[model samples]
Target: MVFKRRHKEKLIEATLFWIGSLTIIILILICLFLFRDALTLFSTHSFYSFVTGSLWYPTADPPLYGLIPLLLGSVLVTFGAICISVPLGITSAIYISEIASPRVASFLKPFIEILAGIPSVVYGFFGLVVLAPYLQLWLDLSTGQVALTGSVMLAVMALPTIISISEDAISSIPSSIREGSLAMGATNWQTIYKVVLPAALSGISAAVMLGMGRAIGETMTVMMVTGNAAVIPGMPEGIVESVRTMTATIALEMGEVPIGSEHYHALFAVGSVLFIMTFLINLAADIIKKKYRFKLEGS
Candidate 1:
């Protein structure tokens, strides 16, 4: 009976190990497939021009493939979303985790979760039918479908992630830490800001990074509202201008692009760039979390 149990345990361990290995293998295969098609574009297109070019007319007479505009559009929209989501999300998280009564926290938590579960397409439709028109009327813009509109919608989509994760992080702090601060004569707000917040800083940072990743990777919402113009957005008023993001560009053009054409390859290159951006964001978040966790544990 002992031998039989040991054999079953070994079988289970081997099965789990192979499952983990298979997941990694699949991810590697996906990366290979994306990069293989992406590299084909550089073979016929100028790498320098592709990276630095401002034009993106893939179906024009000569088919310009400049990537700067799309890259900048994505950057502007994502930055805007981060600015809006991080503060609001973190603040709400703090309230729910620390300040709010149990009843309020319970109510708010489920609402945020529901927001997270809502379809991205529904958000896009709302942005189109409701938010855009209101913005146009209020801002007196020629059209409401601009980078700012995309930012607003993306922020709404990213808020639930940032808030939920941050709340959990803050809530995970040892109650003794708060009690110690209170025992030291610190006020409630001071204890929260100086003790609890610092303790959960790693998790909060991770949440922000993950939220930014989601904002950058979002396709349907941005495509619907961001005007889809493939031009470098001018500053000071750029956020109010129509611009096309990398994801929007891919989603918009992939269907019509010829299967083996340079346009198709260029789209793949865009996907590769997006993959790298999200990968780096996640890597940075992981590193930050580990560094802070190690420091917290050591101290």
Candidate 2:
């Protein structure tokens, strides 16, 4: 019986190992496929010009594939989403974790989870059908399908991730720390802001980073709302302008572009850029978390 139990344990271990290995292998295969197709575009296009060029006329006579406009659009949308979501998410998280009654916390958490579970398509549809008209009327723009509109929708989508993770982080803080701070004559707010927040800084930072990643990578909602113009907008005033993101460009054109053509290869190249950006963002998040954890431990 002991030998049979040991054999079962070994079988389970080997099965888990193969599952993990398979996931990594699939990821590597995807990267290989993406880069292999992406490199074909560079054969006829200058890498530097492709990246720095502002125009994205993929269907033009000569076909310009400059990525600057798309990159700028993504940056603008992500920046706006981060600015709007971070403060609201953190504040809500703190309230839920530290201030709310257990009943209230339980209610709010389920609602946030529901929000997260809502499909991206539904969010996109809401943005297109409801928010667009409202924004247009309020902003006095010809059309409301602009970068700011996408940003607002993306912020809504990112909020759940930020709030959930941050609340967990804040809740995970040791109860002893809070008691000690109060014993030292600190007010509840003071203890929360100074002691509790500092202790959970690493986790909160991770939440923010993950939220930013979600905002940056969101494709469907942004594509549906942003007017899909492939032009660089002027600074300061351009946040309200219609623009196209890299993901949007690929999604919009990939279906219609001829197979084995430059446009096809270029779309793959765009995907490759996006893949790299996501990888770098995740890597940076990890590095930031480690640095903060080290500091907290040292202190």
TM-scores for candidates 1 onward, in order: 0.98, 0.97
Which candidate number maximizes TM-score? 1
* Global lDDT of model 2: 0.93
Location of the lowest summed lDDT over 10 successive residues in candidate 2: 231-240
**Candidate 2 — number of clashing residue pairs?**
0
Pick the lDDT winner. Answer: 1
Residue-level lDDT of model 1, residues 75-168, one tens digit each, is: 9999999999999999999999999999999999999999999999999999999999999999999999999999999999999999999999
Which regions of candidate 2 are displaced past 4 Å? none
Regions of candidate 1 where Cα sits further than 4 Å from its true position: none
Candidate 2's residue-wise lDDT over 207-246, tens digit each?
Answer: 9989988998888999999999999977978888998888
